[model samples]
Target: MSKVILITGASRGFGKIWAEAFLKRGDRVVATGRNLAAIQDLVNEYGDRVLPIQLDVNDREACFAAVNVAKDHFGRIDVLINNAGYGLFGTVEETSEQEARDQMETNFFGVLWLTQAVLPVMRAQKSGHIIQVSSYLGLITVPVLGIYNASKFAVEGLTETLASEVKAFGINVSLLEPNGYATSWSGDSAFQTESMEIYNPVKEAFQQAASTPGFFGQPEATAEAILKLVDAAQPPLRLLLGAFAYPAVKAAYEERLASFEDWKEVSEAAHGTSIKTGN
Candidate 1:
């Protein structure tokens, strides 16, 4: 069965690829971006199956309007992919408070508001999927990308809670954690303001770390994974999209475990009870 999908940030990168992939599979896609021109080719190729809409996920009214258009056009949205985000490379202190807020607004709250806009329709229909395009950095904090990482970390926790809350409504939430995919997420297109000379050392490190599009994991790879998940009888809560994603997640988990072990005694003492379970 063909699904009706609404994807934000569909102008390029993973969003763009996923829009094309779904359309190719006979799904109707309301492909949205700040600039529809970026995806003009998709509209041209897919015709009616691909509906291009101008949307800035950061804009609340625009987010709601996009959902409204999708619902009106297709009668329902089976999948909503929140793939609009960018990288803010700088230390937390080096980055201004407003910059941090902008990161959260785009990467975290942007999805939140958009999801809120779509939730009522999905709840009434009792079927839908929400895919959040996060990063390996979202799972683990990296130098110079603190603001970017913070936003993703927020998504990680927020989506975890959201999944449980909406499960009863037959709504599934999943995070797309793509390690170092060669997406526009690192280039000038995705780079945020970084004018702090104090961050010069770390800033240079991050610039070198950014991946060029189509070099690492291709956007198509992520699109394929998303399509596969869409057809699965039971989809997982988290989709680790690339090989690089797995290791980074594993390392972060291990580090968290080690840190817990190191603080076990203190934690046990603070809890006012024995924390040991004798076998």
Candidate 2:
């Protein structure tokens, strides 16, 4: 049986690629983007199988309305891919109030709003999958992308908790922590803060680090994986994509584990246990 899938940011990049992939495989797609015209081509090719809606994911009410339109049109939505977000290029100190809020609004809270909108529908039907497109930076922070890191981290926490809370309802939540992709994520789709000489070396180091061979993965390469995930009898709660994500995440987790072990005595002392915590 064909399933109905709703995807955000379907104008281009992963969203557009995944939408076409789903339509080709006989699934209905509610393809949404800020620019409605950008996705009209999908309708031109696939006709009614694709519903292109003009949507800014940050708009909470708009998110709910889009979900309703999709539910009414499709009868039921089987999967929702929250792929609408941009990278904010700035240090924690450099990120302004508005910039931080904007990053959270789209990257973090946008996921929240969409997830909230779909829960009622999924709960009533007793089945659905919510895939959140996050980044490896959510687990391992990097220089110059502080706000973006925070947003993804927030998403990780939110979606993980949602997974446990909704398991009894047959709802699955997965976080896709993709490595750096060749999509215009850092080019046109990114926002940069004002440059400061104090952080120029940090910026330089970050640039050099990102210049490693095969640092960028292709956007279309992930389409098949997503198809399998939604089709699976049991999908993972968290998934890391691309070559770079696994090793990077492994190293970050190892370092974190080492720190925790090193501070075991201090932690025990703080808990009023009889342990040596030589400060």
Best by TM-score: 2
After superposing all C-alphas onto the true structure, candidate 2 shows an RMSD in angstroms of 3.2
- Decoy 1 TM-score against native: 0.91
RMSD per model, one decimal: 2.6, 3.2
What does the lDDT read for residue 32 in candidate 2?
A: 93
Per-residue accuracy of model 2 over 57-174 as CA lDDT, tens digit each: 8899999999999999989999999999999997788878999899999999999999999999999999999999999988999999999999999999999999999999999989
Q: What do the candidate models score in CA lDDT, each in turn?
A: 0.84, 0.93
TM-score of each: 0.91, 0.97
Instruction: Please estimate how well model 2 matches the true structure, expressed as its whole-model Cα lDDT.
Output: 0.93
lDDT of candidate 1 vs native?
0.84
Model 1 ranges with Cα > 4 A deviation: 195-215, 273-279
lDDT of 1 by residue, 54-170 (tens): 988888998898899889988899999898888886677777878888888999999999989999989999999988888777788778778888889899999999999999999
